[model samples]
Target: MSSSERACMLCGLVQTEAEFVSKGCANCQSIFDKAGVDTIDCISPSFEGYVGMCKPNKSWCARWLRIDNFHQGLYAVKVDGRLPVDVVDLLPHYIPRDGSHVE
Candidate 1:
């Protein structure tokens, strides 16, 4: 990953910061937009491993990573950093995939 790359804290979408700023996150965009938070607040440059899911619903790896419900794209196996408290509060049914609260 380059210095300009970032991963979404919730969905682990990987992309350039510029892409995030321009396009927003594929999975968490609406939530972040609704929260009125910037991409920096919900994205991190520090992450470990990445998986490109072509078939999220059928891929065991996607299921194991708990990203089966998410859209098909690049996902960080483990994103670093925590989301802001206000952002976390907005997600009543979301579980952190940032290696903070895994089953």
Candidate 2:
């Protein structure tokens, strides 16, 4: 991935850092908004495996990555990071799929 690209810690969606700062996470926007968390705090520059999901509902890869319900876009197979403690505290119902927290 390019240096400017970052993966959303909540959904693994990949986009430029600038885009993240401007738009927040496409899939988890409402969650972040409710938590009052900024996109910059929910993205990781270091992620592995790139996936271009065109049909999330039909793609096996998207299902495997737990992103089948999200919008079509570039995604990281695994995002490496954790949400800030304050953000987590604010989002008691939010379960992150970034591998930072165990289910």
Candidate 3:
């Protein structure tokens, strides 16, 4: 991939194919050097409902996000609508199945 392919979320530095999906880079370390909040804590919460609240209805396409510092989470972005059951099945093994708080 090229630098324009995808940039690191933590830093504005452009990424090549090798680092397209990396959690962070040297630039990220510099940016977060004095930051108070953990960049990984800023993950989007759209999938929380599907994986935690609605796990008995299979009506959406859900998948887990495997990024570092953002593990134990699922994403249902490609899904058409809410899907409880499918979300449950797609939950990562690291996540609890007892409908516990996943934030």
Best by lDDT: 1
Model 2 TM-score (2 dp):
0.84
- Candidate lDDT values, in order: 0.88, 0.83, 0.31
Cα lDDT, model 1, residue 85? 79
What value of lDDT does candidate 1 attain over all alpha carbons? 0.88
lDDT of 2 by residue, 1-103 (tens): 6999999887889999999888888898787777777778889998998889999999898887888999999988778789877667876576666565575
Please say which candidate is ahead in lDDT: 2 or 3.
2
Q: What TM-score number comes out for model 3?
A: 0.21
Lowest lDDT 10-mer window, candidate 3?
74-83
TM-score of each: 0.90, 0.84, 0.21
**Model 2 pairs whose backbones collide:** none
Worst 10 contiguous positions by lDDT, candidate 2 = 92-101
Candidate 1: give the clashing pairs.
none
